[model samples]
Target: MEEESWQSITVMEDKNGEPHVLQQKVKVYTSGVSEESPGYTKPLMKHRIVPVKDIVNL
Candidate 1:
């Protein structure tokens, strides 16, 4: 099971006409079928994505 968290990708258009994507904090969940592992019920680390709107405050 691959848990993909959707996040807002900010972009800054430069004069060179290149879209530079900001490297924001994102939750990378490396999870798979529990049955396959047969031991770990949850992921090794619990990470949550930080929303762009809320990221400004915190």
Candidate 2:
């Protein structure tokens, strides 16, 4: 198989074990920045390459 033609799907599961389609998102991280930087803040959440869409309101 050619790397360019390879594809895959990822399904996220909720706390109830329900599956959901993952969504694409861009996130900006402030890790390793100096504390004096305007964007500096504690790393609250870990970043993932693919993030799941919010389904709480569904």
Candidate 3:
């Protein structure tokens, strides 16, 4: 199973050259158990950005 969350904010252009207050959804996942420790698990966090507006140059 995995836990998830979301947030929104205004910022500058991204690597894709898109500028504006973008709406995005953030997600976080739980990783597998660690090899060094038994019964212990490590959390792995990953982020993906999706552009809701057109790309522009600064």
Per-model TM against the reference: 0.26, 0.26, 0.26
- Per-residue lDDT of 45 in model 2: 37
Per-residue CA lDDT of model 3 for 2-28, tens digit only, reads 445544445667776865454445554
lDDT, residue 53, model 2 = 41
- The clash number for model 3 is 0
Q: Give the range where candidate 1 is weakest over 10 consecutive residues by summed lDDT.
A: 38-47
Model 3 clash pairs are: none
In candidate 2, residue 48 scores what lDDT? 35
Instruction: Mark the 10 consecutive residues where model 2 has the least summed lDDT.
Output: 1-10
Top model by TM-score, which number?
3
Task: Tell me, by lDDT, which candidate is best.
Answer: 3
- TM value for model 3: 0.26
Cα lDDT tens digits, model 2, 1-58, are 1111111235777677766655433233343455344432232233333323443454
For model 2 the TM-score comes to 0.26
lDDT of each: 0.43, 0.39, 0.47
**Runs with alpha carbons beyond 4 Å of true place in candidate 2:** 1-9, 25-58
Worst 10 residues of 3 by lDDT: 35-44
Q: Which order, best to worst by lDDT? A: 3, 1, 2
